[model samples]
Target: MSVWEFFVWFFWFYIVISCISIFIRVIIDVFRDPELSGWAKALWLLFLVFLPFLGAFIYVIVRGRDMGRRGMTASREAEERIDDDIRSAATSTSAVSDIETAKRLLDSGAVTPAEYDALKAKALRGTA
Candidate 1:
């Protein structure tokens, strides 16, 4: 195809993809909304299914701000869960490794028995 025809096809493709993305987002928001009862969700889904453009436009106009807020809250919650996982893994690994290193130091006479005991206790307490 000519370059102009290619550009036109590309433009249409992008528009279609954008619309689908927005539609999916709307659907997700509808379900994610705690205030919306099951019947309300069903009605919104039906409206969007039968009159996509108008339904999507009205949904956005009516609830766009709340949609954005819900998205941010979800993102924050996900980040917090990831951070908690990382912290748990780090603390567990560090405590074990720290105790191992202290044992090695004691065996090598680099640390006295008392120091090794203290290190082990600290590690077990998660303060190492």
Candidate 2:
């Protein structure tokens, strides 16, 4: 084939692949959405199966904005959950270590009983 014909075919191939990718992504997102009822999801899937191109096009046109918003919200919630978990773990470990160090210091006569008590309270309160 001529170089021009090859380029034409490659362009069409890219378009087709892009459409298919978008369709698959949308379908997955539909399934992932907790707000969509079972019947709604089933209807969407049926439409997509029966009329692939037009169904995908209309779905995008109608629900595209909400789809993007939901995706972003999900991502943000995941990040927040991860951050909370990290903070919880760090604080627990830090408090334990701090209390242990204070106990060691008290045993070695480096701190008075009053000082150890204060340090222990601070560690337990997670502010040490």
User: TM-scores for all candidates?
Assistant: 0.78, 0.68
**lDDT of each model, Cα atoms only?**
0.95, 0.91
What lDDT does candidate 1 reach at residue 52?
93
How many clashes in candidate 1? 0
Candidate 2 ranges beyond 4 A from true positions: 1-6, 94-100, 111-128
Error of 1 at 80 (Å): 1.0
Top lDDT hit: 1
Clashes of each: 0, 0
Tens-digit lDDT string for candidate 2 (1-128):
99999999999999999988988988988897888999999999999999989988888899888889888998999999999999988756677788899999999999999999999998888762
Candidate 1 regions with alpha-carbon error over 4 angstroms? 94-99, 105-128
